[model samples]
Target: MIRKVVILSMLLLILILFMLTIEDININTSARDYLFENGFRETGSNNLVTAIYLDYRLYDSIYEAGILLVTVSGIIFMSKKDDDVL
Candidate 1:
């Protein structure tokens, strides 16, 4: 009964918080323009977002690739069984 009440309270709080967040937030157009002016000619990428993601955030991309590789390795490891275990 206590657990159910706690869970219900948490759900209610989450619902209230979700409702409080305003969706229609204004974005800074100047920031976009600044990135475009600096990034396009400097990075040689046509898209500013792509240039930032590929170059400025290359380490993040590498880490993401590593995570993907680790996940694949985990899946492969789980799929394979040793003959000794069988």
Candidate 2:
């Protein structure tokens, strides 16, 4: 009984999320125009997405780099063997 209730609750939550995601709303139409008007030309990048990813949110990029570094380190650590195995 509890399992059925949990499954039904999960299904209902997923259905609500799907419905919410399907509703499209226009929130910011002038965001691009604003960025262009302000002087992205000085940044020396033609693509707005690249400019934003590399410069506007560099801290997030740093965090992403840290994640990659940690992932690589974990992979290397897990792949290593003891002296007897080596």
Number of the top lDDT candidate: 1
lDDT of 1 by residue, 1-86 (tens): 99999999999999888767745555569967878689977799998778988998899989999999999888877887875231
- lDDT for position 16 in model 1: 81
Residue 32 alpha-carbon offset, candidate 2, angstroms: 2.8
Q: Which residue runs does candidate 1 get wrong by more than 4 Å?
A: 1-26, 84-86
Tens digit of per-residue lDDT, candidate 2, span 1-86: 99999999999999999888868655675867876865477566788777877888888989999999999888877788865332
lDDT (Cα, 0-100) at 55 in candidate 1: 90
TM-scores of the models, in the order given: 0.60, 0.59
Candidate 2 regions exceeding 4 Å error are 1-24, 84-86
Task: Candidate 1: give the clashing pairs.
Answer: none
